[model samples]
Target: MTMCPQCGSTFLQPLRCEAKGSDVLLVELRCSECQTWTKAPHTRADMKELDRQQAEFRATIVDGYERSVAESMEALATCFGHALELDLVTADDFRPRTASA
Candidate 1:
C-alpha cells in the first residue's frame, strides 16, 4: 500500500494502466483526498511547458544545493569582510607578560 504523498493518506488505488513499451508498464495513480491523477511512466513530457516544469522538478536537489552553497558563501564572505574591516588579529597580540622566573 503506497501512501499518497500529496495527501499524506494511505488510501491510494490504481486507476488504470497504459502500455509504455513492450516491457515497460505505466500505471495511473489516483488520490482520494485531492482527487488528482498522476501518470507513472519511465518519463513523460505532455507539453513543452509541462516538460520544462517536470525537468525543473527533477532538478530540485541541485537547485537546493546550489542555493544553500551560495548562501553559505555569502555569509562567509560577509564575516571575513567584517573581520578584515575591524583589523581583528590572533591571540598572539594579547600574550600575558611572563615574569622572569
Candidate 2:
C-alpha cells in the first residue's frame, strides 16, 4: 500500500504505470483524500523486453513511412507518364532550375 506524500493519507489510487525496463516501474498514483498526483517507484523485470518492444515499434513506424513515400513516388511517376503520353508537357520542360548566384 502506498501513502499520499502530501496529506499522509493511505488512500492512494493507482492511475497508470510506465515501465522502464523490467526492474523499475513509474507508477502514477492519485490520492483520493488530497486529490493530488504523485509518482511512485515499483519493481519489475529486466529491460530486455522493454527494449525489444521499443525497437519493434520504431521499425514499424519507419517501415510505414518508407512505404508511404514509395507509394507517393510511384503515383507521381504514373501521372508524369500519362502527361507525357498525352503530350500535355514535354520532357524538355522538366529541366532543373538553376539558382542565381
Q: Each candidate's TM vs. the true structure?
A: 0.38, 0.49
Which residue ranges in model 1 land beyond 4 Å of their true spot? 1-23, 26-55, 90-101
Question: What's the lDDT for residue 29 in model 2?
Answer: 76
Clashes of 1: 0
User: For residues 36-62, could you state the per-residue lDDT of candidate 1 as single tens digits?
Assistant: 677765333333333464467559968
Alpha-carbon local distance difference test for all models: 0.65, 0.74
Locate the minimum summed-lDDT window of 10 residues in model 1: 42-51
Best by lDDT: 2
lDDT at 35, model 1: 79
Clash totals, every prediction: 0, 3
